[model samples]
Target: MPSSFCYKVLVCFLLTYSVQYMGFGRVELNAQEGYIFENPYQKTEKQTDVTSFTIYFNQKSSQIPKSDEVRLQSVADFLNQNRNYEIYIEAHAVDGKNYKEDILISEKRSLEVERFLLIHFVEEGQIRRLFYGNSKSPNRTKAHAALNRRVEIRLQQKN
Candidate 1:
């Protein structure tokens, strides 16, 4: 074989192999946006089974009622019957607080509900969704924010 021909063949093979072996470039994940493909935060439907219940805070009550023992008991009964269901506790405050504090307040309210459920027999894993809505709007009256300081539970459909 001619040396030049051999050289050409070797060069072609090298170029082709290198191209196949090398990827385009480094890929970085950032928090600015959510990704579906490589999502570490994604919850499987099995893990996300949810149930929701709402509490209406009465503005005039002046004092928030002890976490609704009756309602929580009902939730406990439901959970006992339907072990497949998971509860999501959400807390919402009437939109009367300063904007900066709404998220914090809402989250606290949600956590409080979670605490009450925990005091009962609900498993922590069963409750996957937790959120707070500080009165963005008067969907529930400010007077009722305490009552509105409620928890919602949802059932995650099996995937």
Candidate 2:
């Protein structure tokens, strides 16, 4: 009888382990019932839209250079043509030990870009701003820092 109980326990353990590690199924929560189990390998539709632009900045400066103004103008033209899209602006700074100052500078960069977009007649509600202070940089080298100090503009279709 004891041997039979041990065999049952071992079988249960193996089944549970196989279901989890082998991705046999996944447990999900629902509004009606407390829980439900579904197939782990179910297929779902994925829609991807890759459209964005990057505007570079000089070291410790949030000013938009004259050369890059044309790029911003192009972006403004695109926005003017596509009224159904919204812009997402992300400003990043080089990795400096001064976290507070870096954050302020990044914020200023984003604001400057947003101001330019506004001046070009992009709707205020259509532009969103985000700032990252040296936190997202992959490398700490001077070149990489220069690359990191830039603003990214992403255009997304309005839902």
* Strongest candidate by lDDT: 2
lDDT of 1: 0.56
Per-prediction TM-score to the true structure, in the order listed:
0.50, 0.64
Model 1: per-residue lDDT, tens digit, 49-156? 224545545432212244444456667667767778777665565444565565665666666666766777777877655555654444554454555555455555
The Cα error of candidate 1 at residue 65, in Å, is 2.5
Q: Write the per-residue lDDT of candidate 2 for residues 26-109, one digit (tens) a residue.
A: 668555322222324632222122257677788889998764566677778778888888889999987456988788889999
**Residue clash pairs of candidate 2:** none
Clashes of 2: 0
Error of 2 at 44 (Å): 40
Query: Evaluated with TM-score, which candidate comes out highest?
Result: 2
Cα-based lDDT for every prediction: 0.56, 0.78
